[model samples]
Target chain A: AQSVTQPDIHITVSEGASLELRCNYSYGATPYLFWYVQSPGQGLQLLLKYFSGDTLVQGIKGFEAEFKRSQSSFNLRKPSVHWSDAAEYFCAVGAESGAGSYQLTFGKGTKLSVIP
Target chain B: EPEVTQTPSHQVTQMGQEVILRCVPISNHLYFYWYRQILGQKVEFLVSFYNNEISEKSEIFDDQFSVERPDGSNFTLKIRSTKLEDSAMYFCASSEGINSPLHFGNGTRLTVT
Candidate 1:
């Protein structure tokens, strides 16, 4: 079974500081990786995804994630953090069975807080 | 851009009662999914529907849960007898393909009291 672990439960960063949210997964093979953001009272929004090729993936809202195959990790990063970027971030791993069945396993999520 | 929509932003049902959550996926989407998140917990995949039938489902989707595409535009999840554990925010999502990004609705907050 595939599982995701986000080490940090909550992170606080000052405005304009760089940010990185760590994510690690345990799976036998390389799997589809994704990062999603959820604002209060809103649905999950796709930040970025890593299906294949290009280890460094860019997404909306100036977010980027790098897929490290050897480490079984995909970490999301931003050069500068804004106050509006405060929200809970989730990292998910997509697994596929031999029969074309697929499922996404999500991590506990990291709550990002930006200080002005 | 089109988006997935779910009916009844919030629903409160008594334990042992039945509840139906409705969703309308994007018109051109080929895959539909239902996921639920308990308060402060990670979202869990309940089931996926494609071609008018269930393509995949997780263990959480027990015999008590059923899904149907009754009409052209409606996809529904029926819980035969709601339990307190069934209380969660149920999200409806749709994707064009296995690799495409899924668009999620605001979700129906099911509160079983």
Candidate 2:
């Protein structure tokens, strides 16, 4: 089965520091990757997605991710983190079975804590 | 922006009681899904519905769970007999088509005592 791995369980960084959360996935073919952010009391919000095309994709809230096919990795990154960016981040891989039903397989999220 | 909406933000039910969680997907979305997350656990896919029928379901979706699209705008998930292990935050999501990003609702917190 296709699966996702987010190696970092929790990451703490200074407010102005650069941030990178690593993700690796195992899939049979070209994978569809996504990054989602969840605040303490809010629903999961789509940060960005990569179905195909450019290796780097930009998303809302100053977020971007790079899909490295050879490494089977798609890591989320930000140039300068803000206190508001302290939230749980999830990496997911979109999969489609032969039946044409599609679902997202999510990794164990990485909780980010930003210190001012 | 259009979004999926779920009702009864929080529901408390007895172990053997039944509970129904409701959702109204984005107006034009054609694919619907239900996912659940136990506290401190990864979000899991439960089932996917399309064309008024279930297209796929995970092992977690067994005989006890059922889904319905009774009307044009309503989608529902019913647990016939809730169990303690059923306590989790259930999310409803929808997408325009295959390969589209899923838009999730705020989620319904189910607590079975």
Best by lDDT: 2
- Itemize residue pairs with steric clashes in candidate 2: none
DockQ of 2: 0.70
DockQ of all predictions against the true structure, Cα-based? 0.59, 0.70
Chain B TM-scores across candidates: 0.98, 0.98
Whole-model lDDT, model 1: 0.91
Residue A111 in model 2: shift from native, Å? 0.3
lDDT of each: 0.91, 0.94
Top candidate (DockQ): 2
Which 10-residue window of candidate 2 chain A scores lowest in summed lDDT?
A94-103
The per-prediction tally of clashing pairs is: 0, 0
Clashes of 2: 0
Please provide, for model 1 over B44-90, each residue's C-alpha lDDT reduced to its tens digit, 9 standing for 90 to 100: 99998888888889999999999999988888999988999999999
Give a tens-digit lDDT track for model 1, residues A1-116. Answer: 99999999999999999999999999888788999999999988889999999999999999999999989999999999999999999999988732344678899999999999
DockQ of 1: 0.59
Error of 2 at A101 (Å): 3.8
Please, what are the lDDT tens digits per residue for candidate 2 over residues A57-101?
999989999999999999999999999999999999999853455
